[model samples]
Target: MTVSSGSPLAPKVVRGAFVRLDEIGIGVVPQVIAFQYNPETLTRKLKPYEQPADKQGTPQDPAARAAPYDPEEEMDVAIAFDAMDDLAEPDRHPQTVISGVADRISALEMLMYPPATPSLLTSAVGALAGALGIGGGADPVPTTTEVPIVLFVWGPGRIVPVKITTFSVEEQAFNSALYPIRAKVTVGIRVLTADYFTSKLTEKGARLTAAESIAATAYRAAVEQKKVLAAVGVASTVESVLATLPF
Candidate 1:
């Protein structure tokens, strides 16, 4: 169901959003995106951090083994896009007539790439100064880039930083500029937990700026909330088991 679905008299609805935060937890202006409509379904997968005793390198002494860690989690969902509603307001969204969903698509696609760096001319000027002995020969702008953190917000219960693992967009109808007016975008993300950060548990060659403590408190809060929900399941689980066994 959509986030807005409810009795007409119900309280205000909360929409899901993708919030971009800087290296130190500050919100990035204009990077926030709220969903127009919620996806019909959300698929989540969890893999426990288990170590088998039979494994060759596994710890033999229970006392020497490391403490159990949180499970790895992933979510996959489809996001729909349509320009018809925006196209209705010609004065407000006139670009839709020519560019269709290009702008919307660009916003999501940009998350996968590095932010724009110094312009070629700026670098050229820097190099020229270095050659003329006006400055250190090292025109050292960072050769590596650290990305801003992205948090997936679904109501108050879940607000965790995540890494986008997979993204695919299927464009349907197009405009004269070859931009899709109708599209289905599927995204897969891996939730970053307490143990995840730069020089920690990360994919090779992948670096996120969360090491600077961006929204880290929120991530821990979300983890605690999930544990509370799991604890609440005890009573319902007992009832179901007794009912099935005719106890």
Candidate 2:
């Protein structure tokens, strides 16, 4: 969550790459949900209450008290990265490693699991994307080799930070399931680029833009598939089934 730059090059634009990925994933899922539930229904379902009366029986304005935390109605998503130390001498560029890992993770998400609900998927993607860039001019291009690790979660659930103990390429293949139930899906990617190549590519800006575009596209595709599955489930509810039953 925190990025420190002791030197100019050390703090590359790529630092925001993971953050953008997270935002894109988080942000998109919500729109899918809203399309299904609609804003009016969501507001009616989650309307805040006025303050309750005090123990003394005096009517206390609801606004006076802190708002209650409703886990069922909230969405939580996060993005993070750890220092890359597992790469061999020839594969040490952090930016490339991270980008590659991110792409792989996005591909897995697009191809594998289905989301529990369209709303949940939309919220997760929307938040993920927003965490990248929304209120700005052109999106910032990443410069560093920092690999982005993204976690997308839905529902009113507890947020737990994932701790990285060791860095191993083989371990990365199965890292998605390491987190407990709170996170619906977890992704960990490693970027590795040779120092010379990274330096050469960083000078052009196009490479970083391409990587971002690809990551975003992959993320959107994955979430869209999740949304489709959710919609199918909703359409096939118990009521619908009973109505179709030949009694």
Candidate 3:
């Protein structure tokens, strides 16, 4: 697939908080596959610092517990694409085929990296400067900042902010010259909660907000529940064996 602005199939640019990926702009679009979503739920137990005991030695506050919230959503996906198609036409590009693929993968890694944070040495030096009463005279130090959050837009509702947690690549086949021609990259991405980047996103238009996240999670859970309920009579499992009729 081609993703260049000139390409016919270029991804449509959506307004609002949609984040652009592949900022460096790869010449070819990678075929994405094995996209999977993993939703999670979290809760806090309320058993105060110390439970008061009743006269019988039992706890007094048994009705204070609350139900857990609905699950949250995360996703994982793989992008497979060929590198160094130029190898077929060595006259077109000067670089070797192997180097081309290496370059592409290297760029992918850069995308996942969070901007550099202040180092221990820098903090130590700053402290020393303050102690010496030379802090005002010291040159300002440059600090790293967080990279932009990415938007995983599969379709209308599938769009969500994501943090890339993992990236794995397999070089499947190589040419006689030991140049890699085929490769597959598997990436694990976690969806950001609506609470994530609170200062950045809102629900006015295309941007996903915390309220939207809750609704999306609930929608996914309802769909899953429907599937489970449908299988109660039509599908069989350990539960079915115990309840099956004789013979």
Clashes of each: 0, 47, 0
Candidate 1: segments with Cα more than 4 A from true spot: 1-10, 23-30, 52-67, 116-143, 198-212, 235-247
- Runs of candidate 2 with Cα error greater than 4 angstroms are 1-145, 148-208, 238-247
Ten contiguous residues minimizing lDDT sum, candidate 2:
30-39
Tens digit of per-residue lDDT, candidate 3, span 169-231 = 888877676655667666676665444444245545556433344434534544466577778
TM-score of each: 0.70, 0.22, 0.42
Total backbone clashes of candidate 2, pairs 3 or more residues apart or in separate chains: 47
- How many backbone collisions does model 1 have? 0
Whole-model Cα lDDT per candidate? Answer: 0.71, 0.34, 0.49
- lDDT, ranked from best to worst: 1, 3, 2
- Worst-scoring 10-residue span by lDDT in model 3: 22-31
Best by lDDT: 1
Candidate 2, residue 145: the lDDT equals 36
Greater TM-score among 1 and 3 belongs to 1
Candidates 2 and 3, the one with greater TM-score = 3
